[model samples]
Target: CGIFRLVVPCGAGKTISALRYALQTAERYEKRRIFYIAPYNSILEQNADEIARYIGDDSAVLRHHSNIVFKQDDGEKETKYKLLTENWLQSPVIATSAVQFLDTLFASKTSAVRRMQALGNAIIIVDEIQALPIKVLKLFNAAMNFLSSFCNTSILLCSATQPLLDELNDYRICPPRDIIQDVDRYNEAFRRVEIVDCIRGNGFSSDEAADFIFGLAQKVKSMLAIVNTKATARRIAERILKLSCGDSEYKVFHLSTNMCPAHRSTVIREMRRYLSDEKSSKKIICVSTTLIEAGVDLSFEHVVRSLTGLDSIVQSAGRCNRNRETICGTLSLIYINDEKIGKLDHIKEAQEITREILYHIHMNADRYPGGALSKAAMDEFYSKYYRSLKREMAFPLKDDPEHTIIDLLTNSPVGSERKQTAGGILLKQAFREAGEAFEVIDNTGKHSVIVEYNDDARKHIHILLSSHFIYEQKKQLRYLQQYTVQLPTYTIEKIGAGIVQENEIGVMILSNEFYDKVYGIDDELKI
Candidate 1:
């Protein structure tokens, strides 16, 4: 029945330290279960592998993500994994995505709430806690408070750039006990990258940005550029490819959500091989979206990140010289003049706030003794960023603007007229309505399309279509998750039914003509 926070810098062994603490604390308190949750599947997979290696048995840890596929060759092992995922009851340690774990508390679906009982007296570790949506912060805080204070569960929040959750003016978490003493001192000591701000005058165009990145990659021999959109990443990658046409040593790679998970994984493995080969003079340049920023174990000599929130900048920097291969890697922050963040209001606001912070740092350089990546700098950035987003933190309902998700969950007058109480007050909660309004990721018009990227993907799709049993079909769908890419409904509609076949399970199977082996999903179809 404790709420705690672990605020250590990235690349400083935070994952292992948190795992060791959770295991010991769970053993001491006799906790029923241990849950390791992260914002991205990549993080969960990496940490789960590490945990399995540490414990000496892989089966001891249960993976509960949409993309996980147990060895289908071993029917017993596959059945064991499926049963464990059904209720999360058998596994002592469960590694899952943040969305799946959060749904247990917030979602109203029967399948989701059935696992809520598993959380009782559990040790829950949420990594990259700041990545949680801004609108859901109040609901998240309230839920965490209830879990720790009433349900006898222990909640551990871990992040390099922790948001000021307890200091919020509205619904907020109780003061969390810090696991590490002198977090700022530890962060300073573990600093591995130097921040270089490149958003001076008019920012670089698409071509200019590619040239800048190519020049740096030539010198460093390994570089990564993380941008805001897939189109921009592709544009930069294509430009870099043309720039290095004559040099067979330079390999330019493009990675984005447009590519399926399996494709991205293959690309990542190839990049790692090139990076680990010390004898080779190969130059590696990867241009990717923000998906690469979350806990991915790929290290580059230098990283170029588009200007966004301070937390994201730091996360991108984590991939640069992660093991401290050099004295200090450089993270160049650039602004792409041609980029358009249409309808991405949150990103736009964060960009503006970051620009202000950069201005402050430029004006008052003497005030920041530890440079831009310092703890003090992060504090200033989040304080202002959170202040700007104070209104949206409550997760307000669109239809009923007066009431919020917290109001609906706690005390909404849903059945007031139908069932009047003695005091004429309706104490009944609108659980269904609240769940309908709550979304971990905004998927308003988003549609998942399963692509036949390789033999493995096509095999899963065949199983998905041919299977008669509901359970087998469900398992096949989960297997297909790695072969799927999400596109907007309008984009799919524009591509027409000729290119996509909508299945009975409400997913589209992309035609081979629209799917590319290298770029993925064909950029020509992009709206």
Candidate 2:
């Protein structure tokens, strides 16, 4: 029935605090269900396990997500967990990925709809609210507004960099009262990194940048380099390996959506040991896409980020000086003159607005010695950003303002288009059309593919494809969670021969020949 926001910055204990609220709400409200939604599974896995332990009962906890379970069960009997996922019932505390939550909000299927009504009166916690894509902001806002107004849900928007959703004219709610009372003090308490502009010389290409990082690797214990694309990440990692003199003792890690969840998990576990060992002199360099910017939590002495949104810059900064173990970590914004990132309009636009903010701050650099990420600088940065992007906060489609998925889902009037009845009830909800228009991950369409990541995943895949025993198949699915990755839909069509194979279940499979041992899904996959 209300909205509350926790504007806690990253690495500032938001997860633990959110869990406390979930527990308190369950106890205070008497078995009211609690829905905790995060933007990525990397966070869900870590937080879900922690929450299950703190709550003192595994039976009460629910982890519902796309990776864990598929929508179609194919005549197999449902497990208790799968049944809960289907009905969204009887669990006091549930954690899910943002994709699952958003997709469910607009899904037309009977199973997906069954969960929506039960969400009324639950405590809905949306973490990393800023990460919501601009194209879908209007739809997301409408969904949030409906949940609070009609469903009577206490919606909590939690993020270190809260986007202030209700600020839009028609979004919803009175200015949400901050759940984290002292915003200024909270940010001050967790100040861990300093932003430094790495604009020097002729600007560095991915190759030159990797060489620069390779040199730094010889001196530093651990570092992270974040780039815009998977291709760029792979190029940098390749450059690093080639530039090595074959004499250095170090490890270069590559991470992206190309790697299955299980592969990424293995890399993270191995890297964590190296990062935590202070006595060990091994240097570690991780080349990754923006996936590492948000949830994966390993701190590094230095972080080099390809120019992107200021919000993403803040996230990248979070990965630095994360543990508060040092004086301050360094966050450098790298300008790759040779690389041109124009395909993604959203990211490119954000980068343009960020550059403008940087220009204004660069003019007064002497007054504010802390660079563009300082409190005052960040305020100005976001001001220009939100102002420039105010219209885009609402979703739009060409020649059809009345037909955007947002208008259809909410039954909102759209300028002489759809009419309502005297009862103020929509005659047609158009659930199927809404679902067709909604694409949480589709900047471009992607196809989910299973991979032979390891022996465990291979065994699970085989069992899942052939097994008739319902219990064993259900268990195999939980095991296969880490072995799935989504590839661009076009890529799957092009590489359809020896590499891509369709299983009996009708899902795509990328053979081992196509999966890279190092960078994952060979950089040459596009061809």
Candidate 3:
């Protein structure tokens, strides 16, 4: 009775609908709280704040994620307690990123399970479910089954382009019934955007993409170009600014993780202001990373998206004509073949398969069901993608007989008393092994720095170095959440003699010369 699916398209009011459903589900089913798990902290914070507004009680909502530390407040110690003790099992309505959600289920640490008791009989809504890494699909699926069947919790899988999870042989997840109502009718009713594939014969180099995007920028009142890498976004945005020389009518901006959350939020607000009123004359062109593709609700007249995955392309399309602001918005899908795309192996593989589907659709339009954004096309794309990466999906451990942690967890060798067998074999989830294996963001050697971008940031930094110790530092950490950036491990290593102060646990302070007001962390230094 707990496992359900929300199969709505992107930009179709999924968040608000989830909020309303959460309220009703809580009231009717006697569920104590609703837990929302988003793919990114930015998305989780954005939605949690919005839901707080709708519920008319900000304090009722508690945010839990890796990026957040407790701020000044004695009454709201539950959140702080979780922070201090690492037990995150309370709150009436909890908002967390997928990383935190998985840690609760898979991590072997004592702190990870302290809150597991609270998960029973709760309402769990997972947004962007399709974004789950292919390698951990089997593990995540099994965890969901445990939560729903054994824990007495209700689960809802939500996404615009929901994957065919039930179709996967290794990890089959079948919902009781899809909440999509009418799949075809719902899809037909919300057709506010058309996807156009312009990947071309050899894909675009950075120069070619920037030139093409600049040309596209001139025609629309508001446009968004989403790239895969921050380096590409910076390079392309800088090139556009250079080419603009004297064009003052158009407002151009660059957005990525390089910018703090607050800075990105400010940029989003400005973009929405320009898009809301047609009478405004100036155009807005934003060059951004894939961060804007999820939960962010601003729309544009056109979206220029670089191909990565079918799920990503759909999310990008959601940002254009999101509320039916226009008759129809256009999605210009292009493929880049250069180093500009970064070294994400999964994305590169998905890129190839997406192109194969698009090429086939281009060759024969009649046979394909719903054009590029149709169900038939996405189904074929993911099916091939999963098949291509089947071996990786099991998440095999190299030294541990190439068997997945999921295999070990389900088939345990350790008996009831937490003791090993006579043959000296130890196997049971390999909690430590699984924890070490998880790399959602892979910030291994990266260091987190509090960027002094404004007065608010500076005030926090002062408290950070003060005698208040970890408590004061943690309070500042909360304040600096939106004003934080992760520099590469190598960049921190090259802080040089007396250049800057650093720590072994991934904390570094930026000197005046290394920080920039515009780009947050200075990208001028070559890593």
Strongest candidate by TM-score: 1
lDDT of 1 by residue, 27-46 (tens): 99999888999999878888
How are the candidates ranked when ordered by TM-score, highest leading?
1, 3, 2
Query: Tens digit of lDDT per residue, candidate 2, span 372-471?
Result: 5554555665566666766565555434654566665566444224334435454455556666666676644766677887786677677777787666
Q: What TM-score against the true fold does each predicted structure earn?
A: 0.94, 0.87, 0.89
RMSD of each: 2.2, 4.0, 3.4
TM accuracy, model 2: 0.87
Model 2 segments more than 4 A misplaced: 29-31, 69-78, 365-371, 374-383, 386-403, 409-432, 443-445, 464-481, 493-496, 500-505
Candidates' lDDT values, in order?
A: 0.84, 0.74, 0.75
lDDT of 3 by residue, 436-511 (tens): 6655555656667666667767776666666346655556666677777787766666655413453522345565
Specify the highest-lDDT model's number.
Answer: 1
Query: What clash count goes with each model?
Result: 0, 4, 0
Model 1 regions lying over 4 Å from their true place: 70-74, 398-403, 411-426, 467-471, 502-506, 523-527
Alpha-carbon shift of residue 273 in model 1 (angstroms): 1.4
